[model samples]
Target: MKEWWRGAVVYQIYPRSFLDTSGDGTGDLPGIIQKLDYIANLGVDAVWLSPFFPSPMRDFGYDVANYCDVDPLFGSLEDFDALVSQAHALSLKIIIDQVYSHTSDQHEWFMTSKMSHDNEKSDWYVWADPQPDGTPPNNWQSVFGGPAWTWDNRRRQYYLHNFLSSQPDLNLHNEDVQDALLNVARFWLDRGVDGFRLDALNFGMHDETLRNNPPRQHFETEPTRPFDFQEHAYNLSHPELPVFLERLRSLLDQYQNERFTVAEIVGPEPLQEMKDYTKGSNRLSAGYSFDYLYADDLSADLVRNVSADWSDAGDSGWPAWAFSNHDAPRVNSRWGGENADAETAKLFAMLSLALRGTVFLYQGEELGLPQAEIPFDRLQDPEAIENWPETLGRDGARSPMPWTENDHYAGFSTVDPWLPIDMRHYALAVDLQQRDEKSVLSFVRDLIAFRKSSDALKTGSLVFLDTPDDVLAFTRGTDEGQVFCIFNLGRTQANLDLPLCTQTEIKFSNRSAKTSVLPETIPAMTGYWL
Candidate 1:
């Protein structure tokens, strides 16, 4: 609560895509430590690291086989400690992902649990007996695809997996499982982690009776998989999740410094669930949704709707926002698809930062970078390969960060990169952007610094200022005063008469032009915070 992640700017670094040092082609902890200066220079208050724990990497380290140690692929535990030390030395807090909802099937606890129904860890995972026909226990589908229930011959039972079958969901109803997971979290807290971005926190609990989820009125079709058809009411977002979150927060409270926990809770009825989980101080610090990341456009109504819903939810339940991350494609691609404008991308970054809560800037977002185009032969993400064409999936978003243009691998690795460096990204490399005053990266640093110095924008209340199509406008203010923010989301100019407001100044603009110039038309992909 003290380090400013609430209404603060947090940078997300997907380890595999950030910067590689081992020549093995994958980015690691040491690489991250080396790049801390770059991250710190961006004026972010915190760094949110995706999973780095030991794993078979079925879901790129989300499938943890060990909670305490760093994987050999990422480097030794010493590397993690070193990274943590270096990050803190720069006064940058570190918030690592905690995937306690599930572990890889290869995890010792799951292996032992699946071996028998009466083992010491048998109840650690969600297990149910097969029906009389010997089919799966329920008809629920995995987020990855197919049945959520995976049959294991060893125990003659089906284990629950909200995601992939490899990621067997943990049974939070079991006291021992909850205790063990909290102890795992405490280990990191003792080792000096400032917080955890709790992965799939709502997934900790499931229907104990193994009830079948009712058929959906609509299965939201996407380019990803066939699994989007159902409402997912039973498989996830159970009412019991808040109890576990409160329990998790209780453990975090015992830590020395002000340790925070932000839950990545998504699915149906997220607004209410997000509020319940974070409303009281005894629970999580904050929670976010897939709303913005899944969107193809950022519109005025969409922005106001989410903010108004959270505002209606009550004040204590804070919200955190992001437009892109390791799981979602780059916002540029989402906004512009195949032909995205660099100008539009920069405008989008500014738009998200001006929202009501703390902002999350995924790596490369500041550079106005588009998603990396992964070829079929070199595609590293299973989700992308599973469902291609319609869904570019997340692999495109996880490509290695381009630090330079001359190097064969864009200065990301000495060996062939884990994923090929897109030629488009090389030209927008950090080295080039840092030198360009008009670059998106410099604009990002300026925006963050401005947000920090101004208390109104930093911890302000958001009020929607109405606007027409392809434009977003709002006012962010506190007890001190207010600043009116506006954006044109289209490539062509948006013509509109300004709303008459007295105490407004052109506080910030994504473009070079000032708001007072009174051009008859707002230029393409331009915005101003007044």
Candidate 2:
């Protein structure tokens, strides 16, 4: 079996915003099927679809009611099978989101568990008896806000929810629950899917002892919610998580085809947890964190510092990097500031692809779409509503994709989408950019092609080159060949003496960048590959 996922680019399609063919104002599986060709044309190896399981819409599809079947809002089982068939024919692998940590309160297991204390499925979810004063079990807080525990009148106990109250955390310590979750994975594997992007995986298990989390040290940036106030030592990231991951890895090894798994590890200590979760082949294929997703600024030092942590050692697991996702703000707005341009977008695309790991490109990223301004009245995300003025919320990043400029609804749907389409996105629509050769869309396509042709960029050892603070330089190489990559992340041109072979040739350079007669200067917001 080929390890195709290593250094491969995976495009993430939030089904709710990809394309809506159902006319119900929501994107569906058939909608994704309709755009497979467009996706394949982008030169990505796989597509990671966010959760489309039956959901109550409380936290959108993240609050899953069922694990095995497709939601009626998206499509039927037949539609999903057809999508897989079409994607496979296009030589595109399908990786679906697996929310193993929690399930919707509407799930049958949770419904039964909350019915009584001694029910057959009572131990399926994390439940605890409240203190004598009727407080929560511990000082843990949900990612959204407030206490992590919610009182359940039916069971006369409190249930753990790292996310919304409607989404209950599973008691993964129970052998029966583990077996059931494994069965869910088997069902999807039988459906011809390629891999899974495990969602909020670090929150899957908690400390059995229920100890209090220590207060976090003071930082320049203040906490946005109660979640950031503590060290999070006991609430999640249990020492036993790797054991469950090993079991998942063994399950994937049973298949004849190469099966892949990439976990989304988000916590106080994400970098260490990323390494711990994917240290060996017996664990996940790769794991990613919010390292780049939530960064306030992008600089040469930031890149160097983050990349330096993941060494090139054989036992270390591969890292997957993403600049933006459904849960975070767009990279252009976060990194490039308010007036970020096409050149800035192209630079980021190059930087992410040139890194030493798998890459995930969110929907509309190739089009250089900025974060949409979702008004308070139109906000649908629970987190955004709960933490309104403090945060921009995720709804802005999840606006509907603009396929055409002149379409009545930007070609997403005939009716207004679940989330409004950002009018600014229409100017950067796919149809408009597809016709312009110098557009960000075209640049990303050419960039992916260039990455595929370079052995160094694909699976080479990365070494940081000593350079000025504003300039980021690195070498990705093996015995067969080597590639030198340099990026001027600053706004002014940077002049530097580079350590390079006299016979070196420029393989690719962004539009704004230029090499001087002496090859000692790089224009701002430009990157070069030699």
Question: What lDDT does each candidate get?
Answer: 0.82, 0.89
**Deviating ranges (above 4 Å) for candidate 1:** 1-3, 219-226, 499-507, 514-520
97, model 1: CA deviation in Å? 0.4
What is the per-residue lDDT of model 1 for residues 1-530, given as tens digits with 9 covering 90 to 100? 35466678899999987878888999988889888999999999999999888999989999999999899988898888888898999999999999878999989999889888888999899989888999888788888877888888888888899888899999888989888988898899888899999888787788787777775675445424545666666778878777777788888878777876788887777777888888767888888767898787767678777777767235558888899999998998887677776666768877887887778999999988898888898987777877776677888889989999888988899989888888999889999989998888888888888887777787777776656777777777877877777777766788766645433566556767644543547787787866
* Model 2 stretches with alpha carbons more than 4 Å out: 499-503, 512-518
Clashing pairs in 1: 219-229
Candidate 2 lDDT: 0.89
Q: What lDDT score is found at residue 41 in candidate 1?
A: 91
lDDT of 2 at 115: 93
- Count of clashes, each model: 1, 0
Instruction: For residues 483-528, write the lDDT of model 2, one tens digit per residue.
Output: 8888889989988787573247776666643443226767777787
Instruction: Tally clashing residue pairs in candidate 1.
Output: 1
